[model samples]
Target: MSRFAEVLGRLAATIEARKGADASTSYTAQLLAEPARAAKKLGEEAVETVIAAAQGDKAGVASESADLIYHWLVALAACGVSLDEVAAKLEAREGTSGLAEKAARKT
Candidate 1:
């Protein structure tokens, strides 16, 4: 696997392991215990990432994107969604035009 995939896999596993941990000690646990809060954090990170990109700050974008992905994973876990399920959706979209796929979703 690519380094990116390997790191994300490890991060996801760590998040899963934090599910029932002490919330006061583990931020991931706190996020998992509060889905709404996790979602809000994910949104905040997303906005930061966008702001970084808009400013043409390559390093900032990369850093903010890492935060965004982490928060996104946490939000997904809090919502009981799995990475495999997300991958399945992406796999299903393979070869489909992005515009067509989006239009199909509007139905």
Candidate 2:
């Protein structure tokens, strides 16, 4: 498995651990304790990632991608989703045509 995939597992574990964590010691705990603020921060980081891509800044893209990943894990914590499921869905789609996939979704 890719190390990046491991990140998703780590993210899940971190969020789970955060549930009972001391806010002073765990940033994940702090984020889990907030909702709207956390969403706003995630949005900001997503925009930063987009801006970095648009600006052709590789380093900026790398930094913002990390931020995006972090906030995504936080948001997933809020929503109670599993990375494994997402990866499975992606794997299922691997051989499908993009156009066919979009058309299939509309039916």
Candidate 3:
């Protein structure tokens, strides 16, 4: 598997393990209890990453991106999606152009 797929697999496993855990014992569980809140956190982190990129702060961008991805995985788990599914779609888009890809979507 590619690096991103490996990471996504690990994240998916972590999210699955966190499912049904006690809120006090696992932060992921706490977030899963309210997936919307976790999703908002991911959005906040994504904004931070954008700000970091705008300022040319590579370290901040990496850190915030990691946080964003973590919360995103949790949110995805709560929504019943798997990392494999996402990876498959990404793989399917490997050779697609951005404009064409967007236009081809069933919107």
Candidate 4:
């Protein structure tokens, strides 16, 4: 696996481990305790990422995108979905045209 993928996998495991942690001490646990809150955080991070991208700030975009992905992963965990499952879906889409994938999803 690529180093990036390895980092994400490790982060996922760390997040998963925090599911049962004390909310007062663990931000991940707090997020997991209220999935809606986690979703909201993901949305906020996405906006920041978009703003960074629109402003042509490479560093800002990179940082905000990392934040976005982190929040998104937390949201997924809050929803009881694993990163492996997400990876599987992505893998299943490999080689398919983006338009074809969209069309297939609509059915």
Best by TM-score: 1
What is the Å distance of residue 12 in model 2 from its true position? 3.4
Clashes of 1: 0
Residue range 1-107, candidate 4, lDDT tens digits: 99888988888889999988999999989999999999999999999999999999999999998898888989999999987798899999999999999999999
What is the C-alpha lDDT profile of model 1 across 14-80, one tens digit per residue? 9999999999999999999999999999999999999999999999999999999999999999999
Question: Which runs in model 2 stand beyond 4 Å of their true positions?
Answer: none
For model 1 the TM-score comes to 0.98
What lDDT tens digits, residue by residue, belong to model 2 across residues 1-107? 99987876777787887886898997788777786666878999999999999999999999999999889878767666667677898998899999998899999
lDDT of 1 at 25: 97
TM-score for each predicted model, relative to the true structure = 0.98, 0.82, 0.86, 0.93
- State the weakest 10-residue window (summed lDDT) of model 3: 75-84
Tell me, by lDDT, which candidate is best. Answer: 1
Please give the distance, in angstroms, between residue 62's alpha carbon in candidate 2 and its true position after superposition: 0.3
Error of 1 at 53 (Å): 0.2
Against the hidden true structure, what lDDT does model 3 obtain? 0.87
Model 2, clash count?
Answer: 0
Off by over 4 Å in 1: none
lDDT: the better of candidates 2 and 4? 4
Encode model 3's per-residue lDDT on 11-104: one tens digit a residue.
8798899889999989999988887888888888889889999999999988888888898898888778787788899999989998888889
lDDT of 4: 0.93
